[model samples]
Target: MESSSAAQSVVETWSAEATSLAGAFRVVARHHPDDIAVKDEENVLGYRELDDLSDRIAARLRARGAVDGQLVGVVIDRSVSTPAALLGVLKAGCAYVPLDPAYPESRLRHAVGDCALEIVVGDPKTVDQCGLGALRVVDPGAGHDGGAPPAGEIEADASAYVIYTSGSTGLPKGCVVSHGNVLALLRHTLPLFDVGPADRWTLFHSACFDFSVWELWGALLTGATAVCVPAETARAPEEFLDLLERERVTVLSQVPSAFRALCRMAGAAAPDLSLRYVVFGGESLDLDLVGEFVRHTAPRPPVMVNMYGITETTVHSTIRFLTGQDLDGKGTAPVGRPLPHVVISLRDRDMRPVPAGEAGEMYIAGEGVAKGYLNRPELTAERFLTLDTDDGPRRFYRTGDLGRETESGELEYLGRNDQQVKVRGFRIEPGEIETALRDHPTVRDAAVIAHDSAQGATLLACVVLRDGEPGRPAEAALRRHLATRLPAHMVPRRFAFLDDLPLTLSGKLDRNALLGLAGAGRNGRP
Candidate 1:
């Protein structure tokens, strides 16, 4: 009882002081001034150095006409400068919008114009190469005077960053996440893990993705070292594994698709490492693949955690810790429970709660919910909603994801609601068929898409066979394997064999590219 009371007091104290991200980071920097904060290939920055550098960057932005409550574009590659630039923007009282230099020029222009960016912090050479020289650019590496301006006094509700996500309208929409939202997420979730100054975390994803937000702050706020993975190393499984072994990364986060490749490499030669937690997010986890990887890790495997979240939910909403026992049963991927501060409800089309086991659209409410989409009022109104609960009126973000409560009270994630398709008056989920394909002995990875053919809308299966598997199985044989597990209408009619599935820059499956492969005459086999 005394311990419980002490925990309550700690929470209350943190709630009062840790209002904004910049403020929270300042507290950490003060405590761990000499501790390493960031480590990139080119540079290593201690907490005090990082703090001082960000202040100088903030001064540069302020001198370049950046004002409070405005959006500042950050178009830098992943490095020591990247975090400093983002922190600088927040310090200047402006939200940072990450613009990937690798993205198409048109996309960068769209984001710049959409957010009305006045000052962009990036490498001067990258700005010119990306043809963003027209905008006012502040080079983070440029020399600055010793007298740095004071950090901005920002409100807790003020926007911290704007991350752009692919929209249904073909254009990208920015999700505005406030400083308080992020602090709430960290305050509730960090206690679950044993993170500390000695730990090392990887910034594996691009800054454009919200997962990077968690990776960056998850380390800085906790005084852990944020290891910046280079683009080339991130693409190569062997090199990335080498990095993990060399850096002694303790908390590793990955999307399942990318991790699958690494698992295959680990099967051949397991590297010596000190990974404490392997957190999976960005996509659904394939239990069979992860189970195999766990077996290979042997005596002391890292704690495997699967997290379900979206860009609008400030990185993560649900958390589940996995074990060998979880894989023993009929392989099921459960995303566990919501964070203490988050509230999740599975609702039907009418916004009413569904029965315990029935699948429904997920509604997430709490401090983790983003403010809303930037410059998209109508769409924001449609997605972000208010409803009356037992606790009174509360605002919730209607996650288009489909999920159901398990017998254990944990949430089981079904695919996206929009991914559900109707063909010949029968509703089907492509993920169901994909899972069936993956269950086959020879198939390593599988993706199923509904294709509009000359006949009608039919399902197309794209598969990657196991490396040492005999010759490719015939389409009919694959169909027979799926038929035993799925209904007749659910089995895919056509198949496409690929050496590897296409993936986006962020490592998620590239659905559009998969659809293109399905439609291509040479790839599809009836």
Candidate 2:
């Protein structure tokens, strides 16, 4: 009866805070103002301080003409200030666009221009480097004169944030997610994790990545402490373990590759840590790594949860908790069941539901689905669909990912239907890498494909040079050229020079043929 009463209280809190992300955080702040809300290596912010700082930042943004429905770009690095900017944007009822300061200027410009972003909040140096003349730049951490701003009267459907993702057209598209979408996601995940103010979640993912949404907001909204993991620490397993231990992190979200690195560093014994939940997402979870992790950890190791999701469907759509038996030298673990309110449908080419156990494109329908790609109605219509269901016309987002339902009704992810690939937990489009390669003067044509080996998948680029285009460029030089235009993950690890790209009889680039060649090149097959 006591447990039932506690469950009822949790339900009531979720229901009351379901209106908006900001509102939910506000509720927590009001209830627990003195509690530590967020902590980074540089600083720690209490709930009251976070609320007060964000309110001041919002007041400053409003003074500078920021209004509801406007999109604000945040080009700051990972820190406590980042969340302040995000919450401030919400306080002004504007959607905040997260931009990594490390991203190429060209890519940044495209995202800023695509959204017609007027105001960007960041450090003064980073803001200046953005090079948007018309952009109104503000340092959210700068001192404010007037009192705290009034809380925004934001509606549930208002745009909360826009996260740009790789597009097949060699550009990034912004997915405008609503406050209600985020609320729904938190609603489903909180109960699953049994999260509360006592938990400490790590913000291990980049601010631009969708996973950070779950990390940052998930903590603040639930009155939990969010500990920021430094970029260098996140990449280095020893440092990450130290930070996790020092912070006493209870919830840790990581990609399979990174977790494997951590396990390799930790060896046979699990370090004494307070981790209760270790969630995996962003890429396919390796069963071998999962098995190794289970063996290395203590008898009551952290519960491993695999979440399958996309940017279009907010951060997560489905989740599966893994047990030691689930990783008993079997195939891949299923992505588990859909969130309570979410509807998952496996549809064929004709948009008809496929039979049980058959592969089909996964379609997500529910509150977590985004409003659509910003300013790209045609593409939005192509991906986000409205299908007739038994109840009525329901909206769905085509994930472009292939999956099959298991006997237990869990979704097992198949590969994508397109050139999109996940390398080191980052979703990358081969077209983007190909486009960058084509930009080089020595390269006439280029095709990029992911090559999988014992060390996992690495990108390989096939290049065709222009006639008499100077001396053949060194692979190192070509990589340097791509580095200026693309992120490290998107850059090809190996390059193969080809006289011409293989083409299908349909006159399209034959990706399968290219993959075969890439595999042979990787294996030193002549």
Candidate-wise lDDT, in order: 0.86, 0.80
* Per-prediction tally of clashes: 0, 0
Model 2: CA > 4 A from native: 1-11, 132-134, 146-148, 268-270, 419-523
For residues 49-142, write the lDDT of model 2, one tens digit per residue: 9998998888888888887789998885768999999898888778899888667889889998898888898887777876764588878889
Clashing pairs in 2: none
Total residue pair clashes for candidate 1: 0
Q: Could you tell me which 10 consecutive residues in candidate 2 have the lowest summed lDDT? A: 1-10
CA deviation > 4 Å runs, candidate 1: 1-16, 145-147
Q: What's model 1's overall lDDT?
A: 0.86
Worst 10 residues of 1 by lDDT: 1-10
User: What TM-score, computed on C-alpha atoms, does each candidate reach?
Assistant: 0.96, 0.80
Q: In order, what is each prediction's RMSD in angstroms?
A: 2.4, 10.9
